[model samples]
Target: MTANPLDDPFYYLNNFQRVLAWLSQRYADVLSSEEQRFIEDFSALPRGSQGLLVRMVMRKGLRFRHGKLNYGEIGDIGSAVAPLLALGWVDEQAPLGLVELFEVLLKAEILSCLGHLIEQPKARKTEWLQALEGHFSQPQTFRDWCPQLEDRLYSLTVMPLCDRLRLLFFGNLYQDWSEFVLADLGIFTYETVEFSAESRGLRSRQDVDACLFLHDCQQRFEAGEALEEVVAQVNGLTLDNPWLERRRGKLLFQIGQHGERIGDFALALCIYRDCTYPGARLRMIRVLERIGEYALALELGETAAQAPQNAAEAQALFRIVPRLRRKLGGPPVPRSLAREVERLDLHLPRIDPTLSVEYHVQAHLHDDAAPVHYVENSLINSLFGLLCWPAIFAPLPGAFFHPFQRGPVDLLNEDFHERRAELFAACFAELDDGRYRQTILRRYAEKWGVQSPFVFWGALSGELLEQALDCLPPEHLRHWFLRLLLDIKANRAGMPDLIQFWPQRKAYRMIEVKGPGDRLQDNQLRWLEFCHEHQMPVAVCYVQWAEQGA
Candidate 1:
């Protein structure tokens, strides 16, 4: 392996070739006819032409100006682009509207093109765009739009095709070619897990199309398209893939949240009724109450309370259900008393205005005997990740598909823990037998800088790890790890902001800090409640700046 992958001028091209080959070999059944042709044709092209095409595909936009495109490795831009234009992969006569034109041209060019219509010559590009929006309803070739500006624009007509390939490789559209560059630069590293027969994210052509459709729907929804229209189109498609189904649920959940934000309670209720996304029921109860349907809200809340989906929903119900009952004019239900946690009140001088409240408390509480680290959620999560590394990264069907994945695909899925129960049980057994400390430390050293969803390596120091291992007992670690497994998504967050460890006593205290006017959030309350129930040493620290509250 090369120390620096980019030392070879064709590094990016090499990566692209690897992806194409991987897909051709592993995903041959799923590849569309057009995709297969592109792969075959792309491979046969001269190295320069291949490099140039990869450069354009990796870039932000489809349109590229010949003068702006320069790569010494891919010498002679005009020569490189000839084969692409011939293949119709890159178009010279692609139409561009005023908005697209404005993005490419300089201020002077825009002024020259539409100076007659502009009331103010010195106005911003946005104002000029609005001034010309109605004038040019039709899109024209960049040359036709700006004939006076002597520059050639090449637009890649195969952007949609490239995007499909990218989606297949990354398993999603959000991650792109930048992942390759990051890995090459040694900024991010990923673990290699064995891929099984069913490891691929998109197993069929229909699955690929559905994933692309969802991507387009998300784009349209974010671009402020008509809500009902987008929702209708989104709801029209029925996906068989559970992963895709979860994505659809999440999109609908977001749409429902947006409706609530815009005070569309009826629409939110309609969405929540059918949406299976986690927390939709909670949102539904709130929406029902918002629209003055307290009885209905109570009905649903009570039903959910009987068997809440997760700790988050159960916590929300505990608060909302009683208030909802009172709203229905029923007998006043007593508020359930909160589990008391250790409290620390301080009015500390703010020496560094740049530092956060958690840091301020950490600095004040630090000593030679007791060292406080602003760990927040990183320490525990990192410890759990390190100790349970083998189980988490174990190769299972449908878990790992690509070389770049940070964790298993089913990490957030409901059955993630159940699928790997035996592996996790073995890992947990290490904690019971006092072998967890060695396992965690060994994994921490070996897997250092490797990507993990749970481990915050930047926040985890060797000293902190050693201190935590010495102080935190195996039983407490087991409790925390088990809670994380119960609901990985919900329980992973909302940990205390600071942890002070007493290595001499083999003791530690997690402290959740709250600044002035900052009350505990629902998640924080849930974590505090959990700690209280488990008899863990945790505290809630309230800080009032002396300047304000003295």
Candidate 2:
């Protein structure tokens, strides 16, 4: 086997020591032997592995490590790589490698390659930028745009060996400029969206658990078992419960959701008023919106907004405010969310420049090399429209990260999780009331639809209800009642809507829904009898599906 360049202690140590000296001059503490070793090992990987390592390091940035690199490491790496890439030591063809080298270079404040790149012609520099812009603007699926993208980049007429090499890091963002793109030139890409979905401990486990729950629930529901019983079964299964801290709130919200599903507004309202966690507090606002309690939901949302500027709080407010207006059967929005999503839109300055995406094309200067082309602009706009932009509009919690890209390589490590959690909290707080709801609750509802998360919500109703009810004033809830009464009078949720409720007969029937089957469950019958015995009228009602696809 060929010896690795990094295996030589002198080579890595000498290089690593110099970088450490550079870092020490700026930092208060001296570099530890462990950190130095990690830097050396990271820099010594082969070209392909180096790319991954560099991104991993940069994502972790400036931190000491006991095990794998953590947030501090990611921060340190970012500080180093951003400048290094802009300075041009880390070429596009080897982003990972370049990131490592750049970190060292930036720490040293030594432009070893900058002197070399400066010798390139001015025309070549301009051409490189144009090619990069072209590639970025085009929107074929990420992998499909490689050929055209790489061709424009790699074929640019830059002179001097160093300038050519620097092109690598500059184009890292382009789909065609990736190491994966190069690997695909002669090899077929495995078809699947999950191509890059590697297991990272808790997240992967949660995904597995959720899938299992869904499978079990489907089986039970299909077997004519009650949905509540199935919910109980899934709720009892305890695998990895990272969400335990917020469990009470989450469960209360879920119970309220169950009430909503069964058309038990009173029960739903009671559950919404009993939960006490942040997650549950958010959910109550959503439930209120769903049951035509828009004004009340809005007030609850406003209360959440006052507590913090977190993404969840902001998103809840954002979505609830607009949705309430719509549910109150108001006129069309003057501007859709997409136009107003600038609420939480973050802008991270381009701190440095590196390789342009054409490195994939440039790599083909070797015998097996093939030309890489980036997808053109119109298509890129479409792809962003379909993928990136929609996420912005729906703005889920922790969705809008601080645009540093490349992270979570050590997800199992507690430090990384804490850092991620903290960052998520900070980002969540950035949204105002309206945007917070839009990002957290409304987006979650749309993404999960009227299902899944709702079931999750059902398990935690008590905590959620208490928090929301406590936060909102009784007068607001009373006003909401009056408005809902008006809506019911105007024929909402099918009329004759909810005239009264009575305990004598064990039920309250406001509207009787009749369909093709025209059947009622025992619960419904009990409710009807109770209402009738107490002198409340049970009105048979008919309604139409807005559309037929279900």
Candidate 3:
């Protein structure tokens, strides 16, 4: 197949107006004249959206075997144009009516690139990093390629860090920066230690080898080398990038540790206070406590404890409060009160360390199948369920484990696949009118080893449970598992110490699923009671099908 001239991606984007005119004609029969017109007048869109749109078109061309775009290929084509609309590239009154088509193009490009990032990290790393360097480099080259980008793109955007980390770490530009760019790339600075005759030139490879030199300095420092000599040789560049500010706290904590090693307690405290990361803030508090600065530690630890996931740190801070009292000879801790004085080594047990909320959710979804022996093997049922989905249906945010079946956005309104599956299951069950209805219910309860007798369940209760199970189809079970897996993701799930629910009850739940032999602990019982007292029905179950282990 002859290449689509549109596929030729190049800089000098505005310079291609004449070429666009001819190519629009060449592919005129393939695309409607309206789309051709959009292509011709592409420069009218906002700069960002225009870049997004052409990139979209270039991707669309790749899916075509012989220069023919199918409905599936073009369904999201409008999204590409959307960036332009979003950026105010084109006015609402503009002549171009194919904005929707442009969106589809954008979606295609996004999906294709994301798919590559997920499936082929090593293969895509060089290109991905190069693209990033090119976008974000001065004059707009690749996108931002810093450690902070990890926090934004993967952590905040909810992209898979596991899949993209290799690319971010080992990309060509990353190697260039980490291995050769050094201080120029903005990571570290260095001093000339024993200036070698071999290292003479300005652009010598050694000048770029900042990381290696930093490692050597650290080794020398550890060996108790003269600090004055090393300090004199090291010129201070001290990175000022705003992005570096994010890691400044970590660096401060490290500096504090170094100060402590050198018996500079005041300097250590100063470095610790300069840290903004909460973990470092808590560490500072701990350091103060260790040094008999109880009052200062209490003040700092109290402040750090207000943030989420700081309970562990708070416990650490609280333990020191009494010790400080004793150190000052204020009063002896009472025998009963002594128990409340937490041991420094025996920290508050992390709530459910082995099983995370996501794992808890997946196990709940598996219901009867969660294993008793270990956390990892407990996911057998959910794993099987996940394995059932089409490979292409690999876990996607918000779509995994959802009750509804997926289709193109265009077909979603009319698709009844989920409803059809539920209705089909109903067809196989004994109806309420049948004499066997009670018998079936009884048998089901007994088979699952339920202690309660099967009764005439309320319509609402039956319907809710039916709908929940029906949502999990055998064909797309993997997607469901993917949803659960995502829900447990460290970044996505956060800490599940407490389950929060919205008024509408979307994106959160408080259901408790149990196996036949399982029993609620005291804390679990109290939680259930608390939830019940609040009038929210926390779903609880002893599923039978998961009997032998999911």
State which candidate has the highest lDDT.
1
Compute each candidate's TM-score over C-alphas: 0.94, 0.22, 0.28
Q: Write the per-residue lDDT of candidate 1 for residues 36-76, one digit (tens) a residue.
A: 99999998888999999999999888889999999999999
Error of 3 at 113 (Å): 57
lDDT of 1 at 189: 95
Better of 1 and 3 by lDDT: 1
Q: In angstroms, how far off is 290's CA in candidate 3? A: 2.6
Model 3: lDDT to the true structure: 0.35
Off-target runs (Cα >4 Å) in candidate 2 are 1-215, 218-225, 238-240, 243-283, 289-299, 308-550
* Per-model RMSD to reference: 2.3, 27.4, 23.8
Model 2 Cα lDDT, one tens digit per residue, 463-499: 2223322332333323222222222211111222112
lDDT of each: 0.91, 0.35, 0.35
What candidate 3 gets wrong by more than 4 Å, as runs, is: 1-242, 258-264, 302-309, 330-370, 376-550
Overlapping backbone residue pairs in candidate 2 total 100
